[model samples]
Target: MMKVEPASPQYFRSSSYSSCHDLFYEPDCPKKAKGPMLCVKQPSCSESNFDCSSIFHLQEAQDPSPSMSFKQAVVLVVAVEKLKKQVQTPIHFISDEDLYDLFLNIFEPEPIECETVELLDQPEKRYIYRNQTIEYSIRDIDKKCFLLQKPLGSPRLTAVHLQGPDAKKEVKINMAFYMCPGNPTQEAVVLGIAGENLYLCCTGESPPVLTLETVDKNVLGSMSSSELQPFIFFKSNSGSTCRFESATFPSWYISTSLAENERVKVSQLGQTAFTEFNTSRS
Candidate 1:
């Protein structure tokens, strides 16, 4: 058995309880709220396996302090202890709200902002590569060339001067129109190449329950996109991060699993865990 340490003098204070050393409360408690009165500290296991019986002395506070009555204090202590036990219980399945709450409590999260990049010239036909670049040309399709569109949706409209063979073709693309907020400009609609809709699907199964896939447009028009299941992209503050909060299931985010396939799914917002890469053109 491990040895238990004695209670420190600083942890104890005078009270109307049986003994002055027996009376104690949470340190640094606010003056407005009555501090949770507890008995002298007792040693037990580590914090990971807190021995509440040894730590909490749920005895009445003899002095009738208006801040918290003895009855209220006991109820609070009981509630806290009950919650602690519930947390320790093994969880075979987790609800979206529960998972989100767990993550929110463990890792406080920040709101995501939008990042839109616009192109200077429009191409007759545009192909968005996963590598964060675009291939377009006004001339023959055989002469298609590449242009780096990293940090997609750049606010500035830069001018590109091409000569000789390069000048033979014109590239037209409006990335800003697709990513920009609100209604798209006439130029954007005419020149923009629509991107595939992304989804973080979950079936509550063993593997690959949470996976990333694009919406299949081949389906019959009679069947709505929702019927086929499509997860829409929600913007955030960071440009590189693909932060996905489900509109159907609020607070839940798209997370990647460490499995061999690197499967994806909806989970609580873990600053690091739930963050996935942007599969779409940046």
Candidate 2:
């Protein structure tokens, strides 16, 4: 027969304890501690009398484990989910409208993946609401993300222009200006392209800067359908994102007016291919 441990206070006794056998022979009792007088059977979960399993006391676990002071599982779950999101390759949208349309076509949730990007603002249908009359305000969250008034809107692309003496200069100009004020004016670089835009990233920067300014509307609106991969893709290499934006763009350059004593010879300024206006800034 099993009785209360000699180590336990003599006055201690639970009303639930029926007999010495009930204490030593209970299911889930530690088998390693067994002696000639003790026997442990599998927990009788199948029994109609069983209330719940008690192999592990969760309340006791909290006291010894990394006891959460916040006491909120939801917060932990949300934090873990956010970390998962940050670690994964970030998903970006070109415009609020296109993203809304993209979201609409998607049915399933959890690490959403879709091959084709759809234009959200459908001009054809007229039903409960019409965008024709609705003028919604929009804001760009740097170049990393865009915040739109509604989930739906027309597809618009972020743009970039690189004009300089050397091919490297073009990239250098793109790197310097595509971030916030505190960051240096140079050294930042573009890592990847998103939608119809370029994503400028740097190892030292907080987030990649997004290029804004559209080269062509049709190109961006139906951009996902493009089958051709051009060798020279400025926007594809440089623009696309709300999660990122430049602190300032490369300053426009002016034509040189060297003094008579100056040795520098005459040379053409930067071409207008980068933007509508010509640039002379190096």
State which candidate has the highest lDDT: 1
Candidate 2 lDDT, 102-169, residue by residue in tens: 88798556686779978987433111111111111111221111211112543222222223542221
Q: In candidate 1, how many Å is residue 98 off? A: 52
Structural similarity to truth (TM-score) of each candidate? 0.24, 0.12
lDDT per residue as tens, model 1, 67-121 = 5556555645654554345346565787899989999889978899999989876
Report RMSD for candidate 2: 28.8
lDDT, residue 206, model 1: 29
